[model samples]
Target: MTAKVLNIIKILQPVVIMVVVQISLAGVNILSKLASIDGMSSSILVAYRLLFAAASTVPLAFYMDRTIKPRPMLTWTVIGQAFLCGLLGGSLLLNMYMQSLVLTSVTFVAAMSNLLPVITFILAICFRLEKVLLTKAPGSMKIVGTILGIGGAMLMTFYKGIEIKLWSTNIQLYAHESTSTNKQDRVLGTLIALGSCLSFATWLIVQAKLSKIYPNPYSTTAMMNVMGSLQAILFALFADHDWQHWKLGWDIRLVTVSVSGMIGSGLMVALMAWCNRTKGPLFVSIFSPVCLVVVTLVGTLILGDKLYLGSVLGSIVIVLGLYAVVWAKSKEKESIQCIEEKEQGIV
Candidate 1:
């Protein structure tokens, strides 16, 4: 009986961990939105966040080096890959995302981000890393999901239906501030957010290659953080010449950077790596919609964000599409695993 309980706990552990990760990510979005509203520069925030991430993760990487045997020697190729990963995933992606958050509502950005996996799938196909078995259910589902996701995003972007009045907490954190009310700003923000998603998808592809080369998650992440910090610092310096924007105080800005760095980058990275190893990427990816739901609820209730009919319908569609792709991917993985087992006479 004890062994059975232990087995059950082991099986459920990844699910619980993923739920926590998604909630933590939702917090990051909320804090980032608040900080942006409070006049924090997104570029500067990215720089500081990556700096803190590097500081917190580098020590762990060194510790991992000491404990793990047969450490791969750091090479120029690894350094180059890390640089690209940092550029695409950390500095570029975060800057665009935060900038879009500044220009748009938190819920909008969160909902749009649900397109990441679909975008990644398309990119993988372009890179020839994934095959197109159109006749197969998995392949057909991928294409269908891609269409649904893109269509949902378009609906959210071009169509603003009547506002849905959800119950509000009447507690406005950034009561005085407002997101961009201008139509141009919203359109620009949506485009930038899509760009960030593309950057993130490309990063995943590059990181996959980097993983094959380096294989040390801790050290690789640390290097990426370091590279991202330097790049973001340079970019922020160029973008914002005002020294006042660089200053951090004991306020939302400080809290945002610290929490985003420590939790979003440091702890989440470690937890996700563990989860990925244990339960695969599909398991981790499927939990993304939870973050969107959390953000929508929290934003509407606490931040006084208004929900539009189009946004609601689009988010639902995107989530359905996300599940379709994840299910298809799982089926593909199972098929491959089955083939491997059969070849090995384990089936």
Candidate 2:
């Protein structure tokens, strides 16, 4: 293949991988809901997931990254990454999100997730990982996209308009009763979910830094998972002293831990780190809003969820906003590359 073809493939590969990551995340959301049905604490579930994730990734880290000698400060940097990503982002964020799912509709949980990219973009700018070139069209598009995405998410959260019934006879609308329909509970859940988004955004910033310092995806993931597992287990032990909550069997809980550990944390974290290294946190994070759409489809088709008008409308807006942001970033990158080439030619 020509260099141009290879370059195009390289640029597009992360986008495709990020989409797969979102789909896997959507599956994790549905499976987590299913697993939680048995009355498992979110903290406990997270603990097990982290443990499994650590076990699964450690071998790969040792095998793949063994040849590279680590800098002394790299350990400290990795620890920081662990605390930011594993404990706060992975364990705490997920636990809070799961709790929110318990209180609100799955659609609400998914919709709220669209706020991630907006949060990450803001954090990225604060950290100097992203630029706000207001003079440029790309910058304007990004700023506008951020506003639209956040606005759409807020609209979805507050508004539950008329239901939109689709024409598929097989897609029956099965309205599952929310655990707490009280307005207060929903509000609380929304707040918690928003908190999760903030933590996750913080993780993206930290991961971007780590990618530069460590530059080892598998080892970084394993270290983070190990630290997260320990932290989660300690929290779970303190919060839920009951031995029964810690019990594991050949059931959905097992499936949840296994799949979540292997695919969700192990695979997803590695992919995210690689993407962050190659594309930057904003590029990786912008794909998060897509999960809302994926989850809506999954909920409607597989889980027999009723499609609501507000959700559909808000999701459409969110998607449009996401596209705008991605387009802006793409154009900005291309423009920068072109300038570099021109400079090289002049030299």
Candidate 3:
């Protein structure tokens, strides 16, 4: 019975955990909308998210790592990496995402997230985190998929107003949306959104490397949330100057804070780390498209947003690109196995 249970758990773990991560993230979006109504500053909101996240995870990490002794360097490395992930990726990226959602429509926001895998692949190759072997189908497909993903993002962004002239991609959708946002705000939001993507993409690579070294994703995540929560709170206190209320009492504010922090930030990060460890960052990157799909459907059906053909086409391209990259990975693995087998036979 015990063996059967273990087998079932091992089989279901990835599916169950990925679903949890997706749900937690979706929940965060709802809470962010609610939190905005309370006039919570973005820093304060994210800080609260981190704080409750840390509080929940600390005990779990301690319990899991109680019997396992790790090298100081390893522990510190994971901690430092987690800090970077939280500070730049968690705090800054999230701040941009929240700010961008306010500036652009939800459609644009979701569209931008779909670029994550493409961005990660580019950054990984550029930074030499991932080797790009031109000879291999995997490398070629990764590059092609990256191009398709970026093209899809552009298509969604410009949509019906797409303007084409020689030597430039003159997108007309920007002009239309520019009407929705005044020049100054448009500039600010665009910068913020792009910055968010940069931070997020960089962090994905960082987490991938960190997962390789520190197998304990849970511990790494718990520590980062602890640090991030404190940093965000400090910023909130000075920037917004109203931490006293939530600090003073337990209310819905406190409840949301606790839930978003622990379950959303803490648990999600741990899941990401675990996914990165077991499946590789390549596999985790595919989740970007999954999130985009889920968010889009929800927004359209629930929020009554209009769907566009370009967006539809872009989503299909993204799905296809995801499959291409995954298939390429399998081919590469098979080739590697063949090489190893040949070497063993000769030896």
Candidate 4:
């Protein structure tokens, strides 16, 4: 009985970890949105967030290096890859995402982010890392999922059918600032959010290659965060000339940077790496929609974000499509594993 309970706990461990990761991410989105409303520059926020992430992860990297046997030496090639990872994932992707958050609503940004798996799938095919076996059910489902995902995003972007009032707390975090955005700004924000998704997809491809070369998760993450901080600082300097924008005060902005850095970049990365190793990336990706749901509820009730009919419908469609792709990938992996097991038995 004791052993069975232990086995059940082990089985549920990944699920619990992923739930925490997603909730932490949801908090980041909420806090970042609040900070943006408090007049924080998105670029400056990115810089400080990455800086904090680097600071928090460096000790872990050193500890891991000391404890793990047969530590891999960091080659120049690995450094180059880390630079690319920092630029694509940390600096570029985050800046665009934060800027989009400022331009758009938190719910909108969260809903749109559900497109990452679809974007990654498309990118994988483009890079020839994934194949298109149209004759197979998995391949067909993937194609179908891609269409649904893109269609859902488009529906959400172009159509604001009706406003749905769920429940408002009547309490705005930043009530002084106007939440209304012009249609042009909304369109631009949507485009920028899409671009961030693409950047993240590209980063995943690069990170996968980097992992193959250097399997040390903590060290690799630390290096990427350090490089990303430098790049983001440079970009922020050019983007905002007001030296005051760089100042950190005892306010929500400071809290936003600290929490987002520690939770979003540091802890989330570690959890995701562990999950990927244990249950594969598909298992991790399946939880993406949870963040969206949590954000939508919190944004509506606490942040005073409006709920739109199109967003509701579009989110549902996107989640359905996301699951389709994840299911297809899971099936493909199972088939490959089964075949490998059979071959091993025969040998």
lDDT (Cα atoms) of all candidates against the true structure: 0.86, 0.80, 0.67, 0.86
TM-score of model 2 relative to the true fold? 0.87
The residue pairs in collision within model 1 are none
| lDDT per residue (tens digit) for residues 269-311 in model 4 | 7677667656755677788888998999888887878888888
Worst 10 contiguous positions by lDDT, candidate 4: 172-181
The C-alpha local distance difference test score for the whole of candidate 3 amounts to 0.67
Q: Which stretches of candidate 4 lie over 4 Å from their true place?
A: 1-6, 176-180, 345-347
What tens digits encode model 2's per-residue C-alpha lDDT throughout 180-272?
447688678878988888888787777777777778888889988988888889988988999987889998899998898888989898998
Candidate 1 backbone overlaps, count: 0
Rank candidates, TM-score, best first: 4, 1, 2, 3
In model 1, what lDDT does residue 347 have? 83
Question: Which stretches of candidate 2 lie above 4 Å from their native place?
Answer: 1-9, 67-74, 125-135, 167-175, 178-180, 334-347
Two-way lDDT contest, 1 vs 3, winner: 1
Pairs in steric clash, model 3? 49-261, 53-261, 53-262
**Candidate closest to the true structure, highest TM-score:** 4
User: How does candidate 1 score on lDDT?
Assistant: 0.86
lDDT: the better of candidates 3 and 4: 4
